[model samples]
Target: MLPEFPMSRQCPYHPPAGYEELRKEGPLAQVRLYDGRTAWAVTGYDETRRLLVDPRLSSDRSRPDFPVLVPRMAAAKLVALVGMDPPEHDVQRRMLIPSFTVKRVNSLRPAIRRIVVERIEALTADGRRAADLVPEFALPVPSTVICELLGVPYGDHEFFEEQTRRMLMATSTAQEAAAASAALIRYFEELIETKLGEPGEGLLDELITERLGRGELTREEVASIAMFLLVAGHETTANMIGLSILTLLEHPGRLARLRSDEGLAAGAVEELLRFLSVADELQRVAAADIEIGGRLIREGDAVYLPNAAANRSPEAFPDPDVLDLERGTRHHLAFGYGVHQCIGQNLARAELEIALYELAVRLPELSLAEPVSQLGTKPGGSVQGILRLPVRW
Candidate 1:
């Protein structure tokens, strides 16, 4: 029998234990999914990157053969951008690219810095020596930045955050995930309607006036896009911030280096992204038969590209297991590869760089309040992150 897919990580900082065995098998290995179906698990770095850009692979989550590692992910098919393929995906991605371009993200650096500083002040206020970084700092910094950019009211963050958490939880039942998704869709639908009536400077308002008013896109499509941005924009970055902090704390020497040198922050953030690989895996389906990695992928076959495994592949990086802040290479698939690569990567990079740097400089004495083993993680979730990072300075 083939090894089951999505083997659990024995350590949160490492890839799933089964991934090593799968890698040893070959770059492309078959694994069984939850529904007793077998799919190709692309564990090699070069093979994963090549497969990501291949036109023969489709990202259509609605397809019957699309490999969902967990059942709850089936409810995410409604996400207009990530679940789309070819002409449709290209069109939707184009509509939102202007907002997330490098120039645009660079312009937001001052604002991001301001948000990070404010969060740090709040975290250290009242002479507090200990706090949960997830809620106080890690979550709020990205949450506020994305909220301001997307025109979503930061006040309602708790509501949408809860809904998103439910929808993304791997253990959620199909019905439960569907319900949570519905609630988010409804919320975005109402928000989009309001934006249509009264526009603002945020990206959502711009989309409404430019695309929706021109009849180029439907209101539902707009809502789905907003929902996708709202969820993706914050959740992944927030998790990265928390985990990056923990990783740095474990390596006091590197943490001290980052604290003393502002220039090292950018490279450190890139290394952290490569090391963490917060998002579990990229999913796709074979659009046609393709031969690569010494194996033939039949048409309609499901493929799982585990980012953690690919980032840690020995062929890709020297001493792949060691976290070197000076890795200096941004060639990893933390934001994925190809046309479907993360649209918001620029923004995420800015947030991570700003948050980690500011935290290191502002609170140089920061350390984990609780033991690493005692920290909790999101249970069986597709995204790997600490549920709560108790820390002190």
Candidate 2:
């Protein structure tokens, strides 16, 4: 029998066990999803990379045959840039490039550094035995940064974060997901309207003053993009921050080595991304018939490109399961590859580098407060991470 799609991970730090068998099956294998639909699971590194950039594959979720990873995705309208192709995708992506440029992201380094420091200070300030790192540090740094960047009040984070959680949770019901989506859309609409005349210092304000104000894009488009930024910017990094710390804590000698040599922060960040690959899979649909490794994927066939499977492939990385900070090769699909690669990766990298380095320096004695088996794992989500990470110095 084919393995169930979105197979559960045996452990938080490991890929789903079924992925190992799928990789051995060949570059491509079939999988059955909860909806009783079968999709082609691309398990090989080379094939997954090739198909990610293939024009014959479509990211458009509107297609009736498009693979829906979660209920929220299935309920979503094909309105966001993620669901666009070619000219439309290119145009929308270009508008947001200015905010995500290497220079622009690098310029925020000091702010990110400050954010990390402040979070660490707060975490260590309270005279308590231990604290949940997820709430204490991980969730706040990115949430505050993105909020300040987008001109959204940090006070509203609870409303949006809860909604985003509902929308992304794999177990979310259709009604719950739809309501969350509706709430976010409504919030963005009101926020965008407020920014029209009196622009703020955030990205949304810039979009309003420069693009929307000049009629370059519709109000709906600007709001949609802002909503996308809110969810994508904070949630992924927040999860990574919490989970990466847990992974590092599991390897104490490595953690000590990193603390001793601060220069390893960048390499460690990349290594963590390659090893964990929080965004486990990239979903697509074959736009046209394409032959891959002796298997022909028919048009409209759903394709599941799991990054965890490829990142852990022996063909791609020797001792793939081991996390080596000095692993010379940094080519991993953590943020994905091709034209659709993550736009905020530079920013995410900066945050991780700063957070991990300073955490080690500030709390060198940091250890897991809870047993490894006791750590709470968020069971079903496109992004795999811990719900709460308890730690002590």
Candidate 3:
């Protein structure tokens, strides 16, 4: 029998060969999390999609009756858009939606592609042959893209990077992640202040000034939203670049497809996000009452919708385990559904598309330097990320 995996450390991304066994067992499986709390993991595509949009499934965990699975290390009062239900959640999400519109995000694509190409060019230059792509390229690519859009100073990339690193490292204790998050919040607060005083041209500054000009949002609200945008903006795309590269390296045929079909790069990124399924799990509380997967969820019951598992469910994608770049790319829920879908997804798509295109065109000879198993994965925390990826052309 497989050992019980906890709700906290249960990494669906850390699956072994033939991991489909877990998804096939059922749509809803009980997981014993690292904290020993039982979490219901949803695996069906429709089920997961429905769960995300259901008004009955609440994102707020602060309800005294509904206990959260893990310490809410990332937020206070959980004002996060992802951690909310309608009305309140809608308002918070709508506040950031304008900044992440396709038009706004598309304007950043040229700049994003420039950064990806420059980084890749730098990586292969001046007699330096091989370097860990994560730090040198993968991590910074998205970070630079987000910083540019947010108008946050790139001078603080090192600072943002350190905090992001500690934020996701496997061994970082809850206190460590909490400390890093606090530091991030504090840093954003200072940045917001500077943006307020200087009023430079970037998303953060624009957002602050716009909201302050209107009576819609306060100074603190602007800071909090800016902080959320920065963290979510960079963190998810960073995982996509690394994990997508690894997935391509593991499947040369797909990588070759990306090389030949430049137009397919966007869909390729979506497929990779689905196949790699790096976002892993989401936490929510039942808002009222709902029956899902034949189980009744009571009001205020904590629930976890495992995005990784649902991506692999056969009922959703025909031959679900297969990573076909040509498959139904639009159906993937790597971005959640309804009001809570990632606001920065359009920007993320541009970033991922550019990164994959650059990697495919530039590093046609690239392959893993060692067995994939040698790489480490963090089973818990926010983003499902690899510790190191050794690669060479």
Candidate 4:
């Protein structure tokens, strides 16, 4: 039996580089959450994937004895959209997925390209030996594009992004984090009101006029959807951009190939998403007693599927940790697997392709100022990727 882990000291997002040590011991491990709760982490790929799509893994922890990492109120509020079981989750996810399909994002490709191009050009024009690409380029391109796609005004983005950062990081206190979430709801609350008065030619507008008119969503549901998009679209893409830069710079040969051959760009993004896998571990709880990896799980036990670990699972991928762009990178689970895979994956790909293509082509000399081992993560527990990535053209 594995030893008991004290949760009060563990920050799953910042677990040490040797995490696979614990994971390899078994698919299931007793671990500590930041709040010191006793929860289980499910680390095996086959078993983890099964549990994610398992109907019994309840996402709603609002029940008095709800299964989760935090208290009912906080967990439900943070994961309300992604955490709900189906019928409830199915309807909400369906309403949002159409807006993020490849067709829709492809239509916005030229616009994504334009946004990416402008930022890279600005960085190149500065002509510095090193550039803080995180804010200068990575952060803004996705922030503004998603806003336009969602029909939010540019002025509102700065505020939204600030509040999101606070919400994502541990930089803020619990009270501070709550306030930021409330402020965002207020902003989205106001946006929903405006869209009601005069709808525009964007996803959120169409969602309101067409769906709400047809009784597809409630007013609160609309606000929740808008809130979900704003948080996910910006932060996930921002990290991808920042992490991809770090990934390429960490491997100059791959960077050179992308710079020299435009054909490598698409495959490279997939490879980077696979290699970096910044989304890291995803969680689910066992609904009832089930046998996995030959061990029986009791009902209500929480499971943590470390996608980063699984993507690097040697059994699943040959020599898994290597960053091989030409390795026919199709089987990786960066976007996840089965029913609960990322809904915004298509949009994320579009944004990454546009941003990365422009950066590689324009900044032919793009390289990192510091090694990957040295950078710190952004505060708050929400987003964790290569935090401060410096680059040069």
Candidate that would win on lDDT: 1
TM-score, cand. 3 = 0.91
Per-residue lDDT tens digits for candidate 2, residues 35-80, read 7888999889999899999999998766777778766677644256
lDDT of 3 by residue, 171-211 (tens): 56667767777787788878877776788888787777777
The Cα error of candidate 1 at residue 126, in Å, is: 1.0
Better-scoring candidate (lDDT), 2 or 4? 2
**Better structure of 1 and 3 per TM-score:** 1
lDDT of 1 by residue, 1-393 (tens): 999877766666778778889988899999998899899999999999999999999988878778777888887545578898879999999999999999999999999999999999998899988899999989889999999999899999999888878888777888888898899889988988777778888998988999999999998888889889999998899889999998999999999999889899889988999998998778889999999999999999989998999999999999999999999999999999999899999999999989999999899889999888788765433688888899989
Give me the candidate number with maximum TM-score. 1
Model 2, residue 196: C-alpha shift (Å): 1.7
Residues forming the 10-long window of minimal summed lDDT in candidate 1: 373-382
Q: Write the per-residue lDDT of candidate 4 for residues 281-386, one digit (tens) a residue.
A: 5666667887778777778776666666677677777876778777767677778776668888888888887787778777777676776556766432344476
For model 2, the local distance difference test gives: 0.85
| Residue-pair clashes, model 2 | 0
TM-score of each: 0.98, 0.97, 0.91, 0.90
Q: List ranges where model 1 is wrong by over 4 Å.
A: 379-381
Off by over 4 Å in 2: 77-79
- Shift of residue 297 alpha carbon in model 4, Å: 1.8
